[model samples]
Target: MATELTAPPGVRVDAPAIQRRTVRLLFVTQIISGIGVTIGISVGALLARSIAGTAVSGLTQAASVVGGALLAVPVTRVMTAYGRRPGLVLGYLAGAVGGLFVVLAAVRGWVPLLFAGMLLFGGSTTANLQARYTAVDLADPARRARQLGLIVWATTVGSVAAPNFAAAADATTRRAGLPEYAGPFGFSAAAFVLAAVLLFVLLRPDPLLTARRFAAPTGAPDAAVARTPQAGAPVGADAQLPVGADAELPVGADAELPVGADAEAGGPGPARRAGLLDGLRAVRSRPDARLGVTAVAIGHVAMVAVMTMTPVRIGESHAEADVLRLVGLVLSLHIAGMYALSPVIGWLTDRTGRRPVILGAVMVLLAACAVAGTAGHHTPRLAVGLALLGLGWSGTMVAGSTLLSESVPVDLRPAAQGLSDLIMGLAGASAGAASGFVVQFAGYPVLTALAAVAVVPLLALALRPVPAGAAGAR
Candidate 1:
């Protein structure tokens, strides 16, 4: 119930506190949505393989990847216009529709229809990705990292359960005399519906709006505005203003302004423009951003390369269908590693800083690539490599996100995040398509080796000393 305080035009002051209920609701909604998205991804690939034959599965996946890349800009614009809630709700609805189409395609064995369904379903996954940004909207500056981390961690529940859901779908569909492939899509649809309902009902008052309302006052003298409730009250309640509510006092009347005040004190115009320009400029001028982007982009390329090629490679080696099952298992393990330690990564970033984590993650990624490139033909070794790859991905992703957050002001955060995700989507899409070609020609080992080499410049950049003023630039 703290009084709403406006900072300088573009600078946003951290809110007094985030409500526990709000956080819990957002977390739960994201978890449910994540499960739906994962189910779609896990099953969609298999369905594509089934309908179009293994030879064309890569093409189908590439279509979905390209679809995701195409969707990013429009999705971000929608979120900007309507706020994340409506965008998310609409995204879920789109996914549900897509799921139904998948089920229909499976019933009819329509390859083109199945591919179209997958492209539509990809929206769900994109929406879930945007959920992390929403989680940070209401968080205090001091707690933003942890808040983002928590949302990322929440995805673990869904990711870990997704494969089981796929298995359940397989069983249930067969029992019901329906096409086996339809079951996962059905389950995905239900989960999306549930998530949509939860979001519609629970995300009250809008976290972003609440944060804006509760922020510390800016520019005006303390005496001009009334003090609101205690620091710990629920965000939107009205509190009593202090005695001199209308009286203007000296500029420095109160000591110990809230956190993020310095940035807030500057008038909004310059800061807003700077925040926008800073993110773009960082990509161009700062080695850290550039290197981080390169590492992530290459890691994604390597991941898609090995992952898309694995089942084919195993089949060529005269492996059983169970080896395909092993791919699913490995993927599940990989996802677990990617999301399970997010909170820990967030805490570490907050405590130790982002550069060290980035460097460490790069090292792990390098090692993982080496393992996959050399020893991964063996089952056990492959499993280990995939797990390490997942862990490395998690570290780099969390660290990179934290770094981006630190580099940009809150107002421009959404745009910056959107841009980053767009880049990632493009990179992942290109990699997914190219990996198949690379494996078709160059072999998996060479592809992984190239991925390993991609990280070297990033590592070198991480090793460089920060200039004196760079610390404050963020």
Candidate 2:
């Protein structure tokens, strides 16, 4: 009976060839898509400031958040039905169209239309966010977090180049007598179109589909097929079945073993089908998840609120050219901070526990906020604060994402992640717009103070102990 039993799900499962190919293709496509996304985001606020002026700059940031929130469900449904390839292709197409509209808006100097275009263009970011899940679609549970982290790190290449691309676009616009932001949007459109083509043409058999196929039962015998004990059997043979033909077990009546007879007697267990509600329940039940989510959500709110306004504030104080360069530098540093530490963060989560990293991130962000508040328009202080903010964001995001990954089963991962991202986007948008109003009406110091205050509860939650059962799961 021990030989007839199927191997444990994770112990012997091998990734399908198609799944490997899909991961490679998606990695390439995502890198290109990242470039397009970076271009759009790098230039978006500048475009808004140029066209809509200081009063409605927040609307640009708000458009992206609203688009992400609105499209989260639909995007998840697309990935569910058509698979990741088509969903990604369609998303890039939408982004291309949106980029065109942005260019037109810039050429015509239409603020509302530009905002609309930004909303549309920003929908692609939703697709980009989903890209990490695609990387882990067929990965083993032990390697899933690492695979996700690798894909995220891949985006660093594009993100690092994005500011330079935006700068080039800005220069091109001046030389061509076009609107200041037209070149970036045009370049972004081309990049999206290219990525869409690559995804449609190269991503074959889809990683998600491959995972589903591998998980299905083959209708083989239910009894464990135990191998003949050789002259030398490993000591752990009692605990684990031998690989291949070594552990053939008897069939029929001989296979009938007493229940709970041996630790390794059972065949592969049923696959876990975690649904959306299941993920939510996991989050609700896990104190660690709750604290991690709170830290991420609040930290994101503060980060976006301050980051969104930095360029505009700098522009108000310095020349447009100098301010744009400064904005580009800050954004580059921010992206570096966001993605560069993901692998290390994942390792830390696996080793040191999620709470310490999360709490430390919140403390760093609090310090950043305080620094930003007291900088009194000092560029160096602002730069330092922004860099720290990026570091804090990285820690929180990696820890939060790792926590979320563990909470949901493979099936529900995409939807649950979408929901989490959607909520983050909503909070970020609201805070960003409110920060603008606060900065305009009150001052940057007041805005930063409010963000610092919001971090307090997150810190408390991060420090709280998990229940005994919950701790066991971690």
Candidate 3:
């Protein structure tokens, strides 16, 4: 039987058990929180259109993306200082508050209030995104992608189901003496609260803190150090941390791990404040990591640019009275595509390699754009195209995220991850904000084509040769 790994200083722990417990808790959290976020997404734009105008409809999603990106700074710092549990709990509660604000905004027909609420609502997404990172805190290197994918896959149940409930949520709120559009946000607020309480009560010992303890030498001083590279130490290729895996990280992450070498050799050293710039530098210093960020950012931007404008396209093209219901159904199908096959995407990342999968994802994205661009009022083709778009996003997100996590040394992982997410959020925000204007002028087909263009750079980067000693680069 394989020996169970334990932390040092006479404090023993079954790493596998902790990991399992962590995954389960996070999975449940994802489901509950997923419903909260997706419910808002299904109707946020339409709600904005009711109060504001078509040009500003996309601002709701943009605000959420911006909120998530900006929030990542403090959340990452909290996780760095305290641990995952506190940070995650904080994020969820903030999202719940945001949901309340959104409900109030709808009641008052206030666009500014709606945007503010949407920003706060973004906190739920931040927590959900960060949870994936938490899952890998103590994961076996060999199965890291699969474990990460599982948490993402768990989101399918809630995300796919939430959109279908749009009409029900609307009716429920109408009966409650509230605006129909306000129901989803109100229900979402309750969901976020539930998720926060669950983490606060059950997420014991903290995955990140435990992982740090396990990574430390058996009797070495507390490894709760900040993840800054040592002064005068090399932060280049020679400092690469190895990860055992089959495929390289999507675009920039290395798939190759030189086992048996000290992971800390020339890597991040003694504790220091790992500021955002430091995190950015860490990713920049590593070729594979840099590429991973590129993949994540571009893929996110492309997905957001297309998805945010889709409802408007459908509503404009179809004059049906049940347009809202149609929007809800279509979004449900799109979300299903995004999350339903995550495990398979994760497994493929492990089996086929990150680069191949990412490249394939790029192709899939391009195809989605092409199909949707020409689909116009053709509901079936649009649905198929949106589904493909979701599938492509899943591939990039899983593979790119896994690569980002494994590329850096454990100590530096949080900082690097924070930087990556921040960039990704910003990229998505830009796309969301611009999508409105683009579609307003150039049309939806033009927007899809532009989104497709944005990902070409990532594809080119993924095809480039890996640098020597890059982690997860096979």
On lDDT, the candidate that comes out on top is 3
lDDT over C-alpha atoms for residue 21 of model 1: 49
TM-score of each: 0.78, 0.75, 0.81
List the global CA lDDT of all models: 0.62, 0.65, 0.76
Segments in model 2 whose C-alpha atoms lie over 4 Å from true places = 1-13, 16-23, 45-58, 106-113, 140-143, 167-180, 210-282, 285-292, 312-328, 471-473
Residue 422's C-alpha lDDT in candidate 3?
Answer: 92
Q: Which candidate is the best by TM-score?
A: 3
Tens-place lDDT digits, model 2, residues 43-74: 78778888888767646767876886667666
Q: Mind giving the per-residue lDDT tens digits that candidate 1 earns over 1-474? A: 113344323222223323344567768877787787777777666777777777876566566566565565566655543455666677777778778888999889988788777777767766676677676665544455576778888888887777778888878887998686678888898888888777766665454434433333431111111234443222222222222224321111121122222334532211122222344554555554555455556556556656666666556554585766777776767776677888887787667767777788888888878877787468667667777777777777777765664443333444556666667777887766677677778888887777777667778877777776552122
Local lDDT at 14 for model 1 = 24
Ranked candidates, highest TM-score first: 3, 1, 2
* Candidate 2 Cα lDDT to native: 0.65
**Can you rank all candidates by lDDT, best first?**
3, 2, 1
Q: Quote model 3's TM-score.
A: 0.81
TM-score for candidate 2: 0.75
**Number of backbone-clashing residue pairs for each candidate, in the order shown:** 7, 17, 9
